[model samples]
Target: MSTTSVSISQKLTLSGSSSCNPRLAQAPWEFDAMPGYGPGSSEADPVPAHAPTNAEARPGQLPQLYRELPEEDLHERIRAAKEALGEDLVILGHFYQRDEIVQHADFLGDSFQLANAALTKPEARYIVFCGVHFMAETADILSSPEQSVILPNLAAGCSMADMADEDSVEAAWEEICEVYGVDPQNVTPDDDGKLPILPVTYMNSSAALKAFCGRHGGIVCTSSNAETVLEWAFERARRVLFFPDQHLGRNTAKAMGVPLEQMPMWNPRRPLGGNTAEDLQQAKVLLWHGFCSVHRRFSVAQIEKARSEHPGVKVIVHPESPMPVVDAADASGSTDAIRKFVAASSPGDVIAIGTEINMVNRLAAEYPDRTIFCLDPVICPCSTMYRIHPGYLAWVLEDLVQGRVNNQIVVPETVAAHARVALDRMLAAKPK
Candidate 1:
């Protein structure tokens, strides 16, 4: 049987040789104290170096007692807490989460899917989200006010989400509106009945960015529904300003036959987003300079290597990868699409996947009859998602059972109102 998770975890614990960072062998608490994105596909990314360490962002330490407990004991504690709380609690796990955490999840899927799951449990008082910060925030936004969303660890933040902030996006919007000679807050449609631009943010972004989209007649999009969302945007606007994920924006638009020249990259650091006014005017989609660190590690070279090693290998990748990598893959899609692809494959088919190692590994374990493996051979998971170890999940669940809500993710009411508009549009834009 293909046991990728076992190999990866063994390397992390016993050898520490499969990963780029040897520090990954230590407990998460040991590395959370450091100033970096932690060990994973983003181990070398420059963006996380300047951001606050996981320890600093967290409300308090994970506590020595929890960290010192054995892995099996921690799992038992989580199980006990769940039993004690019964229907009052629901745990949501992302596709990229570790096996230990995923096994404990009441709902296992992508960020949006998991968020939607929480809504189904209206009677549940607490939502323990075993995902990144933005995901928990999204749950808090979508669920009823009485329900609470908790992140297992405060440090589990997306590096890509950090790339685009409110200030940078707001500044770009002002400049773009000026170039079009329109008010940033109140843009009017031209004779063609299309607004000058419509803001669109990926699900990987912060709640503030999503709120910005809501206020500006924009919509939020997941990787699976991005094309449909873009089609929705184009129906109301001449151009789409997509943020917090350049690859997803560019790849989806390009698939829809938008010319490369018409999709410009917006660098917030540069003047006019480092583009000429003429270029901006001609653009169909303005992609922000942001990307998921895990997906960014995929390359055309890796695809070629997989193809060479296993003839007739079907390579599937996430759209968050670079254009060339997606182009080289046999198919590129969201996490759910990838899962469906594997499910549809023949029992003996060889599949190479380009995504977080944990997700790929889980798929491999699920379909042991097939030769399913990650395109990137390195055992790097998403650093942020990996931060949600069993220890954090156990601690959070126990705390909730004890009537304490730790690491609760609450979005401001004003922001949630606007964000809800964009999210609702996203829900409506789902292709028929």
Candidate 2:
């Protein structure tokens, strides 16, 4: 989620928008280039761009289309459902969700932020999370037991989170403890000095894993505030164990000037902890062997190509990408930061985005005067995010209207308590 203040001339018109369906809109969006305006140059020409590459092929990438209502009727139905459901319904959309569903979100942010938002709405009996399954579970953990969290599509899941499960994480933690010849509880400290290990989990993880973190004085984080959460951990511990997203963990630690060698990737499958004391003793961050398939698809070549093709293009990428990919781009940040930079940017600027395809397309539409295109030339939408179709959203809302709760996501009481501790730490870190 990074932004750049570069400028370019002309509008972008890629070939993919003319498809009959959203899924078929695969052609590269075209943008005009300005001379000498791109990275390393004050001005340059923008080049034609390609679609996103390495999109995760999540199952049910397309939900079944049950809604046959016309545009006006559909909106009317959605409004009526909301009115009937009243306080019992809440819609939460993730930052990477399609604009169609996001436009209807009552609350919008990253997974961690969205979960926190859900907690504030005590009156909402049913929280319809518009993100992936893990995000819905996070909201469930944060919300009161009396509340019900529903995912529009259960298939929506984070691939990164899938990389780390409770068993695997537990194994890794044990290995870390054994290698250090220290108890997990005695490894890290908090201001209270009560908890032994500060088990921090990423929002992308499973509820069970999150429960593990909660049980261990750890919290969850989205890409936006991961750095702050990690920093908070350091203040209370000898080292940090970041789960479910090695890229985010590595990049955040790197941003803090933590030596790259200090961050070791823990592999639960094999022993020796997948790291050495040299790597661990010097460790500032302990990364789980996990990654987002979609984010990892971004490459340095894409950025370089963008620069050469679009003479004046500014490169902006999400930190979830590999370090090289992030470094190749002119800027890196959260998705919200990227959007803000583009919306408020000056006209005639060229932007090459390294994010989901739908998001880049929406931005291009929002800024017609500026040249905007995605960094990856292949299809690269987050498969999990794409699982949340308007059809599924409408169905979930309609079910709530009918006084039925389907697909309710609930974290156990024990797990909830621990998860809250982790979540509270993050909320406290939010800038006042």
Candidate 3:
């Protein structure tokens, strides 16, 4: 895809001068200069060195000037930039993002929906994704070549996605091939002409892994359609390797009547993935040891508390939550599913949601008559999702107005071609 510069008749002036925000002048995560503190560093605290120190930092921090600017001024600048750019720009926001950023989004939905939204906007030259890193990468893989996908903050990365890197997964695949006595080069299909094993990656994974799936005849799946994708895999493969989130894989497979004994966890750190040849042979689904930090926080205790405090409360959670938490909740679904659940509820209905704090708060405000609150009283937002501050949004948009593309996410041509096959298969899989 060719990258085109946006031209504006009038240069939009930001609320604060460039001097006021020194960090904004340069990318925060310049890991090349800091040898020991780049992304995926083996430090005790896995956060990148350039991650924001706090929501409010001293004058030198990247967002300090943004924090200092009046909310009205920031809003005004964002409006002006959007108006000046017109249809060439499209802003996509996730439900979990903070109100400050979500309010400025032209389209709001979950990651999969947002990726599809990017495809629909063929006229949009730039897709400013107000979500995490992987979501932008997905948009880049699916959108037209002429369209450029921009991520506001480089630090906005998914911890779950980081857990299952391409190197680790590739290594695991080789070990599995040996354990199953299957040749990676020449795989003999079953009597039914199905492959012995298939790799099914969650939509939250990297583009490289999606390409890996495409090359191996596997497909991608979102939380909303995981079961459907799994069924599709099972029909053509004897066993499946599901990755990035063990909770989702286990829960979905269990519901489909797969026994726990048949599902084994693959620990990348251990030899043979911490499983014996016998264990591998009996496995129906090999799950990766990865989970979402936010969803992992939910517990059955929280569900009980909601039930005790408000009798007849409806408990709905994301499928990423642990099996027990999902089982205890009244229902579990994707972010869009949670929204629809609340919208379908009657007035005065007491609903306790198990998701990010920002989304629950927004729902409460949108439906004032209904009593909607987060299950966990303590504040816990997706730290990665929170990285897309309004300041970053303004910075990227303003850069576009000046005929520049900042933090653009582009997948390699071969990778995009392969990844698109899996994504297209996902789009075709009908939900049964």
Q: Which candidate is the best by lDDT?
A: 1
Put down candidate 2 lDDT per residue, 194-255, tens digits, no spaces: 33335677778777877777667676777778888877777777777888778888888888
**On a 0 to 100 scale, what is the lDDT of residue 279 in model 2?**
72
* lDDT, model 1, position 170: 97
Ranking by lDDT: 1, 3, 2
What C-alpha lDDT values do all the predictions have? 0.86, 0.68, 0.79
Worst 10 residues of 1 by lDDT: 1-10
Judged by lDDT relative to the true structure, which candidate is superior, 1 or 3? 1
lDDT of 3 by residue, 1-432 (tens): 000000000111132311111122222333223322222111232532323332322122344566567657877888899999999999999998878788899899987678778888999999999998788989998888899999887667676787788888889988998877788655568778888889999998989989988888889998878999999999999889999899999999988999999999999989988999898999999999888766887889999999999999999999899999999999998898999999999999999999877788889989999999888654445655755666778877887999988889999998989999999998787554
**TM-scores vs. true structure, each candidate:** 0.95, 0.81, 0.86
- The numbered model that scores best in TM-score is 1
- 183-293: candidate 1 lDDT, tens digit per residue: 998998999999999999998888999999999999999987899999999999999999989999999999999999999999999999899999999999999998887
- Among all windows of ten consecutive residues in candidate 3, which has the lowest summed lDDT? 1-10
Instruction: Give the TM-score (vs. native) of candidate 3.
Output: 0.86
The TM-score, computed over Cα atoms with residue i paired to residue i, of candidate 2 is 0.81
